[model samples]
Target: MGYGELIIRSYDAQNDRGRVEDFERRCEVGPAKRVFLFTDTLGDPMCRIRNSPIYKMLVAELDSQLVGVIQGSIKLVTVHKPPNDLAKVGYILGLRVAPLYRRRRIGLSLVIKLEEWFIANDVDYGYMATEKDNEASVKLFVDKLGYAKFQTPTILVNPVGHRRFRISPNVELAKLKIEEAESIYRKFMSSAQFFPIDIGNILRNKLSLGTWAAYPRGESWGEVPSSWAMLSVWNSGELFKLRLGNAPFSCLMYTKGSRFIQKLLPCFKLPGIPDFFHPFGFYFIYGVYGKGPLSGKLVRTLCRFVHNMASSKSKDCKVIVTEVGGSDTSRLHIPHWKLLSCPEDLWCIKALKNEERENLHELTKTPPSRALFVDPRDV
Candidate 1:
């Protein structure tokens, strides 16, 4: 029978061990051979999808034969600060086909099933990621599936190496116990676009190597002060930094009320934003908005404080990377630093829905571009 006659279905946990073993055997000739081929012990490749308010899965099948699988999850994408409206978007990951089924429409059929799944879940847009050099996969996503390149996935590298960060006298850095830090993080995230990075999960899952936070000393007591930064070290000792600041008051004034105008406008008033606030300005950097003085002096102080902390933490790490879109202000500052190729590449598509198409214009006010960052493992 033709491969087109094969079937694709939601991953069956009962049969996953066998399926994974089969996949391993099929991909033995390519780069996939280098990595261990074991099904995630977590069992649900769609675990993230299940947690998502909007998630979907599909399998391609012809008669009773399994041919391929597709999975997607929904989330928001922001060019800047927290509280950005969450959009109905889908991410396509874990697309696989058995080697024997090559050059068949099974993969395409699987994606079509995913598209239907997205429509049912109210998702108007979809995106996925792939290695830059994966020609066949790229062609399939772009040429065959009609997916467009939204951003170039990049890996940024910091050849400077990792060293212990020292806090600037003007700024104070503290290593909050995980429990205490998570408490503060949860409270502060209510107004921000912060994702809950469970410290406990990090510890238990061995996802985190270490974590720390930095803020102006006197500002720590109430509301957990939005004007601080956090750094989490992953298993590879790679550093991920998040800086918090106020949203663009001017943009707010142009659209919303002026209540936060006083707080968010000052950063723009400064001769230049601090290095720390520039999202794409450096490797291993990320940011959120909070209330703060936007003066050059204040910016410099904050940047110094953050720099001290990051520099010190680099001691154990070999490389750092951050993702940024083309039109983000952070991109403007990136020219000031050194960078290298990133392994995590992005694959994005335009909105397929009319309302969402209009929303895209609003959300993505800036031009689209790809970002690169160096994976620590390669360093």
Candidate 2:
């Protein structure tokens, strides 16, 4: 039941849920119950894996105890060049090993197995995201696995409240069908992560309320629009809650938390509102993009419109959150309250076998210091 008796296989929810819970609580220190984040399709393993077309969840067991778990997904991303230009990329997420299994190389083994799974599925490139301060994960993916630090993204939490609801009459927000949304997204967004091909899957998700694009007043979508911005909202409150055991709220506030403090005073983060939501519910906005010189204005307009839309639907909807690369200037337009900022998250990547020599844009080019649209739908 010790080392040699360990087993790694696809996730078996019935037998593994208990062990997974142990691993979850053991690894995330501060608050035990607070770690269960609300996502669409609650309790489903695929939901935890970021809802990919093809994905695998692996778990390691010893004496029938689940010691570790990891998930990987494949997506065909259209790079800077399109029209038959695509990269079958593999993404690794949700890697966790029990505290007791630390330094046992079990973490490394799980990653290797997931990579093998990626290869078997015919992925041309592999990548993963982790905090810059996570020395173990960084080393595991970079030094040990030959992956390189790709992008450093800043994740911002923008709360929705009265101010956001004051959207200007000059700004018009329009909901778009998947086809309409993708047509524009593909045409304008170059740094987007997930391909337009799978966007329907994300927009149609039960947790996702809908998608929208913003065009300045007097300029409508499908018209000669000078600029455009788009966003999709997720009903996180309906999914799950963060129960931060006994950790002091002050401790969670990292930087100048005045902004976050002012907003949370209303207890928006608290659970159980008029909407039958036990946990604090908010709109998690993703798949956002702002293009054109007027994009900054469009970005602000889109955010306000989405926030107001969410607030009108649910009084509990009090925040919008998204992640962008540090080099991305779009962060300027996307407002945020600096409650806390995690260590910079680095995207590390590596090339897979039989990759096209000429069409390896993912490896050849780097994103500009402009807006980078990382679809939160991916994870």
Question: Which is the leading candidate under lDDT?
Answer: 2
Model 1 sits at a Cα RMSD from the real structure of 15.0
* Deviation in Å, model 2, residue 229 alpha carbon: 2.2
State the TM-score for model 1. 0.54
Candidate 1 ranges with C-alpha deviation above 4 Å: 1-4, 21-44, 47-51, 61-66, 76-84, 156-171, 175-211, 215-228, 231-344, 358-365, 368-379
* Cα-based TM-score, every candidate: 0.54, 0.80
Superposition error at 23 for model 2 (Å): 3.4
Please provide, for model 1 over 1-379, each residue's C-alpha lDDT reduced to its tens digit, 9 standing for 90 to 100. Answer: 5333455556665765455445533432223422222232133445434544456666555556556666776654332212344445667766777667767777777777777777777766776667666776787878897776656534333422222233357565555567765565445443232132332443333434344555676766345554555444433332122222343555334423332442467444322222222222232433221234422233334334444544564443323444443333333222223323444455556566766665555434544332222111111
Give per-residue CA lDDT, model 2, range 1-379, as digits (tens): 4465768899877976656655655565322343333222334544545556787889988777778888888887754433454678788887877777778888888888888888888887788887677677887888888787767878777655554356778777788887776666667664454344566666777887777877788885767578877877776656543333343454445312544554567455332112111345566777677778887888877777776776667766656677776776667787676753342667877777654534444443655434456654554
- Weakest lDDT window of 10 consecutive positions for candidate 2: 269-278
